[model samples]
Target chain A: MATKLLSRYPWATSPFVIGAPMRVMSGPALAVAVSRAGGLGFIGPGLKTTDTGVDLEEASSLIDKARASSFKTLSSSSLLPVGVGFQLWSDDLSTAMGTIEKYKPCAVWLFAPKEGQKDLDEWSRRIRAVSPETQIWIQIGSLGEAKSILQSSEKPDVVVVQGTESGGHGRMADGMGIMTLFPEVADTLASSHIPLLAAGGIADGRGVAAALCLGASGVVMGTRFLASSEARISRGYQNEVVRASDGATNTTRTLLYNHLRGTYGWPPEYSPRTIINKSFIEHRAGTPFEELKKRHDEAAKSGDSGWGPDGRLATYAGASIGLIHNVSDAERIVRDVRNDASRRIQGLAAA
Target chain B: MATKLLSRYPWATSPFVIGAPMRVMSGPALAVAVSRAGGLGFIGPGLKTTDTGVDLEEASSLIDKARASSFKTLSSSSLLPVGVGFQLWSDDLSTAMGTIEKYKPCAVWLFAPKEGQKDLDEWSRRIRAVSPETQIWIQIGSLGEAKSILQSSEKPDVVVVQGTESGGHGRMADGMGIMTLFPEVADTLASSHIPLLAAGGIADGRGVAAALCLGASGVVMGTRFLASSEARISRGYQNEVVRASDGATNTTRTLLYNHLRGTYGWPPEYSPRTIINKSFIEHRAGTPFEELKKRHDEAAKSGDSGWGPDGRLATYAGASIGLIHNVSDAERIVRDVRNDASRRIQGLAAA
Candidate 1:
């Protein structure tokens, strides 16, 4: 079953490394770079549904340019090497389906559905109808969600089992860590033929190797990509991710950041993990939401300076940030992780 | 460092499995059974500090009986094969020190210190003074704790980096998953000679292999041992643990059970993860603590019937309870996990 899943992505290597779609930060440049380095990369949800078409067009242009330069990264000419992700709750399906049909990306990663598997089934069926060759990927944080997928009308080609340590949006209260979550999900879906991918707190080769040992066919990295050079992010935010240490103390899963950014309506069960800053500190210190919002808006106008321990802007990241020390390109990050995982696995066997 | 750590326990195999001291549930039989199967086992903290002495005396008698037979688990005459754990916040240090002086256990696993490393340092110094052959093992759930150990007056022989998925008393809010926590702690204490062990949500061989891949010299299992036939646990509790399939939905980290059981004074930063039952559900559903406590006390007299979804007793366990399907003897459990981890690591290398 795992081999069949890997065969679908011919360009990728063993213990596949995936660049998780982290909102707008994971754009065409980052996604293409990861894919080019023998890993799968998916463009994250955009500011607007139509924005996806713009990014896919740019991704297509970049792939064409690479092919023209004899890069030979992607062998399949008919399919775009990169994938695109969507937040099923807020994203427009028609726009996503239209964009998928036009670009024919290799995959469509779906997450945060409002109506659970029902929404996922609708999106998965429509995406397959529009882009027959594109595989469907669904992200789930709980075992119950994995079970629901089995009963759905349309099954996903791959399931991403994210843990509570994941950054950005994740299960609010009931999420289990990947150490237990992935294996349970894998055990339940052992006969389903849907390859399981581990996500959450995977920032380096150690995490990559650990996920593989947990029976993950592959691993996905979201926060690690946020520090990549190709990420569509402000310098301040990247710096915070690099500078941050002790994520258990520095980061938290809260909706205060979302509210401060004027973004709301995420499912009640979902919350984003971010590096705590002045806004959160003040909010917890009894500062009213309105006052914190005013400060956050003021910080947003300060550009890169808005992100830091003292900065008020939200810096979404995973608990693995402490492991990420320096900023590297997406391709190097992928290669380094893959090589490290191989070395660790071999070292254990030798031991 | 890892080799030196393993050499201390010559009878143990690679990927050493430690039966976590699970608050009176892990007794002499379970610890000795695990040790007999080439793994280290720890007696959990008892109802009183002096109770640990009683358990240690029993463990000493059990070891003597094994020694009288053909069993050759512990080659070292000076060091007892089994280990003992203590809750520093409540366990009287004098009583524990006296027990260690008399038994000279192979290791001492210390956790939930109210004064953090200060208490640990005191325990380490006194333990060394009393029994220099015994190793000091400190349990930490965050990187900060790992860092703090570096500055302590006495260093630990082994550091157990436990994730939030751990049951019993763990870091309530700042604890991270072992996937990220272990690696980060390993990176920070790279220069320190303390061998690191991964704990939390680790029920089987998959978790053992995953922990080793994440740079752990060994792994610890608390919740899994709860289902072991040798564990000092009630049949109903073991059945509930085996019956539970989804830790994310079936278990939670809360103080409701603690208060209901009339067990208080756990440090504010620590909480136990337990399988939810009628008492917890009632507390969450607006039933006052007093009312819940009354029902819990009433249910306690029902023996094994006091556990399960409808019962009111606390089923203290990690999130890995879902992965444990059966109650096996401790010796068989240890051997199976060690063999499985070896197979998994080899499988990854082959892949």
Candidate 2:
């Protein structure tokens, strides 16, 4: 199955762009929209649940709907194959493998493994055995992790190099920027022949073009798609992404937001980049965690008004927020970025 | 002077790739080599003397030698119009102005102004009055500083956006990456029509190409050229740059290296990125500054051998060290990067 995917990789009409499997935000609808527009898209980890199993059921239904809708829009040769992601550390293996067996996604994105390469190897093997057509895609934040992946017994079919400027959880202490990291990783893994995808801080055509220049086979954009109508994000969060500029000033990597939202148990090595708000300001001023959480909860009740300067909610985004302005359709975002990148590359060649 | 430079900017064959005015490293030879290779280059601020007039005299001689040599290789139309840089806070303004007037450099790079925009405006005015043909280029690290530049009474011909990943002095507390900062500054100043250049962690063709995608009219590389034969860098430092990889693990931004080298007095808002050595390890382990400095001074006497893992000397480099594998001629570095970027851009377009 991996071989089949690799065979088709080089002949794609446009440079591959992935709708990153951002937890909660990236859904089957978004995935179908992107894949139908000639890019790969993934249903994120949040769709897989442990207790009631309602999330998985909904995901299965959405996947069915997406396939029908995508088949009508895309050519038969261009596969509208939706990928699926799983948080390796928290997700139950049997449940994930069972779901994969049921859906047979084109790709499986594994992230935040508790046992690192050991778990990654196990997950890859399991996915391959259950659904041979599913290619393994592992996300790494640093060169050390990339090296580990290369040294593993079972290698991934695709490597996603996520830089610190990425919106969600990434390297906490040491992470190189995509401009340098992507090329270095590409150079180091040149012999492997595995396709590399760049993520983090990429928002538009310029970023897509730049990623290609940096030796990436494709680019996976999480933040840019967050502003898409298909993304399952709040109006407040979407508004913040549109209004924001200068990510260095507006966003901070912190575990505070996750803790406030009652989502905990993520590895200590990672932190999400969130837009700075009153909660973050108060946290920096030495306010106790309990007090801040209380304020955050109170603000959450206010709905859309709960995420501004005076609000206390997380607005997950990357530094590339400055480039994102309006909320548009998922297909428009993907198509525009691809067309713009193509034009820019050709323009550069002419110049 | 600014008007003439601005008028000629659009006609440059390739996107400008400046050998940045790295203090003590970027010399007249490097500036001339880059200029001869179809890019702008600047002799660094180290040539500007505070009290003694010897430095300026030596610079004048080097410039003369560079011109004579450059004339042999470059066409008359492609003038070796070398630039000059100054540490505005420390340099004696009259002496620096007098030197610029005599040399009639094509551009002037002003850094570390004590009074920010006010000082920058005054310097721009002074340089214009002395040499009307010399373009003013200011380096900034944040959107706020860019805004300040935009609001200044006298605008510069070019703005160099220096990210935290840069090698030398840059914004410490609130620096943004070029991917986001460049586009934001570009959009904000679009109405003004000021050309923006990206600096920091750019080493090879991929970096140059990526910077172009990020909306930079040019790129200013300090560390990439440090490995060039024309740069005035020590063999030890150059070797480390070639050997280093995984910039996230190898390089760190700290004032410890600056203090150890007895090159203190930079403003509190700046720090330099250097490869981790004995001094940095000890500093991280809580060694007293006095002890670290003593060890560093002792290691400096050992010459080339004093810059490795056990050595205490600084190996200043950007996070792009992984891409720099060898020390090559300045002209080769410039031409190869340009050609490679052109090829990559074209290749992507075809793909």
Over the true interface, candidate 1 deviates by an RMSD, in Å, of 0.8
Candidate topping DockQ? 1
Clashes of each: 1, 2
- For residue B287, give model 1's deviation from the true position in Å: 1.0
All candidates' chain B TM-scores are: 0.98, 0.91
TM-score of 1: 0.98
lDDT of each: 0.90, 0.79
TM-scores of all candidate predictions against the true structure: 0.98, 0.93
How would you encode candidate 1's per-residue C-alpha lDDT over A1-351 as one tens digit per residue? 557777888888877999998899999999999988889989999999999999999999988887777657586546899999999999999988889999999999999999999999999999999989999999999988988988877999999999989999999877888999999999888878789999999999999999998988899999999889999999999999999989899999999999988898998989999999999999899999998988889989999999999899989999999999999999999999999999999999998
Q: How close to the true structure is residue A205 of candidate 1, measured as C-alpha lDDT?
A: 92
Residue A183 lDDT in candidate 2: 81
lDDT of 1 at A236: 98
Question: Across residues B1-351, which tens digit of lDDT does each residue of candidate 1 receive?
Answer: 567788899887787888998889999999998888888999999999999989988988898888788667575546989999999999999989899999999999999998888889999999999999899999988877887998987999899999988888799878988888888999999998779999999999999999998989999999999989999989999999999878888888899888877788998989998999999888889998888888899999999999988899999888998899999998889999999999999988997
Please state the error at residue A68 of candidate 1 in Å. Answer: 2.4
lDDT of 2: 0.79
